[model samples]
Target: MLRALRTAALGMSAQQTSVDNTANNLANANTTGFKRATVVFQDLLYQSVQRGGEGDQRPAAMQLGSGSAIVATQRTFLQGSLMQTGNSLDLAVNGEGFLQARRPDGSVVYTRDGAFTLDADGRIVTQSGLALEPDLEVPPETQEIQISSDGVVRVRLQNEPDALEIGRIEVAQFSNPAGLRSIGANLYEQTEASGEPQIGPPAEGGAGLLQQGFLETSNVDVVQEMVDLITAQRAYEMNSKMITTSEEMLQIANSMKR
Candidate 1:
């Protein structure tokens, strides 16, 4: 009875984690460049008993599994749908890669959100004021900005007849992008498991091409997340019922007269 109770408790704990992850995904369904995460579970070690005897026609060793646990939460890197906002500053990646951004401490972070804006110094920056990597500076008299699929930034000045090239935006890739640590605000930090970032221009070396006037939508599927939430809820309820049944069985056993 105690083993059953403990097993059910472990199951409930695992289901809680699943529910949390599902809720987060659902909440970020409309977030730009958001990636959905899923919980990975692993069965606990087994308790062995009654080893088989040699040449005695007895079965092999029998074991009872302790339960399950949430081993890891894996981020899915599936490509998100693109939303055309018609904003010149908005950009989207059509494939694999991440845009580079520098934090206040000068540390680099990776992101798929390309909703960039200009800062007071005319430098291209994210919505949170972090400067984009490579430090592009738009001239004061710039009348129009244009980004090419190849990541070239061209601008037309107020008095200029021809467009001039400003800079090129490059993307970074990792061997295992899912290994990155999420630091919030659509940013990701590299880790040993993620490997070093490979920086280069778009549409090269497995990097995605840039799409001007568009933004990458969150990859989370609301219907799928809802199903997962329902499944997790059911699992939790079942675990609770198992604990209650086990407790009732213990009560019945205790009521038996000697």
Candidate 2:
């Protein structure tokens, strides 16, 4: 009965983690460049009840699982739908890649949110003021900014009929993007599991092409998340019932008359 109580409690805890992950996904359903994460569960260590003899015809062992645990939360990197914003500064990656941004601490991070804007100094930066990697700077008197599908940045200055090339936007790819750590604000840091970033120009070397005037929407599906939430709730309830029944069984055993 005690083992049952502990196992049911662990099951409840695992279900709670699942619910939390589903809630986060639902909350970010409308966030730009947001990816939905799914909870991964693993069975806990098993306790052996009987070990069969070497020459016995029966099974080698009889075991009972302790419970389940939340092993990892994996983010789905599937491409989100692209929404056209008509703002030249807004960008979207049409394939597999992430834009590099320089954080406040001078360390580089990866992101899929390309809703960039020119800061006071005419430097293209994210909403958090983090400058894009490679440092694209526009002239003060520039009339128009144009970004090509190949990540080329060109600007037309005042009274200048010709467009001048400024700089190029580059994207990075990882062997395992799901291994990247989320630091909020649409930024991800590479870890050992993610491997080193492969920085290159967009539309070349397996990198994704850039789309100006567009932004990638979150990949969360509301209906799916709702289903997962319901499933988690049901599992949690079942575990709670199991714990209650185990307690009742213990009480009955203790109340026996001799």
Candidate 3:
């Protein structure tokens, strides 16, 4: 009965973690460049109840698992739908890759959120003011800014008849993007599991092309998360019932001793 109680409690705890992950996915359903995460569970260690003797005809051993535990939360890196913003500075990756941005701490981080804006000095920056890598600064008297599908940046001066090329945007890819660490605000830091980032021009070397005037929407599926939430809730209830039954069995056992 004690073992049953412990196992059921662990089951409940695992279900709670699953529910929490699902709730986070649902909450970020509309967030820009957000990715949905799934909870991974692993069966706990098992203990042998009986061991067969040498030359015996019986099975090798009889084992019982302690319970289960939450192993890891994996983020899905599937490309999200692009939303047209027509804001000129807004950008979106058409396929696989992440835009590089320099954080306030001078460290480079990766992100899929392309809702960029010009900073005080006309440098392209993220909503949080992180300047885009290989920084491209716009001239104060520029009349128009144009970004090509291949990442070529051009701007026309206030009184110029032809546009002048300013710079090009670059993207980075990793061997295992899901292994990257999420530090919130839609930013991800590279980890050893993710391997080194492969920096290159957009649309080349398997990097995604840049789309101006658009942003990537969150990849979360509301219907799927709702189903997961229901499943987690049901599992939690079943574990609770198991714990209750185990307690009742213990109580009956105690009464018999009276």
lDDT of each: 0.95, 0.94, 0.93
Query: What is the per-residue lDDT of model 2 for residues 1-258, given as tens digits with 9 covering 90 to 100?
Result: 999999999999999999989989988999999999999999999887876664575657788899999999999999999999999899999999999999878899999999999999999999999999989999999999999999999999999999999999999999999999999999999999999999999988898999999999999999999899999999999999999999999989988964
Overlapping backbone residue pairs in candidate 2 total 0
lDDT of 1 at 50: 59
The TM-scores, one per candidate, come to: 0.97, 0.97, 0.97
User: Which segments of candidate 3 are over 4 A away from where they belong?
Assistant: 52-55
lDDT string for model 3 (1-258, tens) is: 899999999999999999999999999999999999999999999997776664575657788889999999999988899999999999999999999999878899999999888989999999999999979999999999999998899999988999999999999999999899999988999999999999999999998899999999999989999999999999999999999999999999999978
Q: What's model 2's lDDT at 233?
A: 97
Instruction: List clash counts for every candidate, in order.
Output: 0, 0, 0
Angstrom error of the Cα, residue 165, model 2: value is: 0.4
- Candidate 2 — which residues are off by over 4 angstroms? 53-55
Task: Pick out the ten consecutive residues of candidate 3 with the lowest summed lDDT.
Answer: 50-59
**1-258 per-residue lDDT for model 1 (tens digits):** 899999999999999999999999999999999999999999998897656764675778778888899999999999999999999989999999999999989999999999999999999999999999988999999999999998999999998999999999999999999999999999999999999999999999989899999999999999999999999999999999999999999999999975
Candidate 1 lDDT score at position 81: 95
The ten-residue window of minimal lDDT in model 1 covers: 49-58
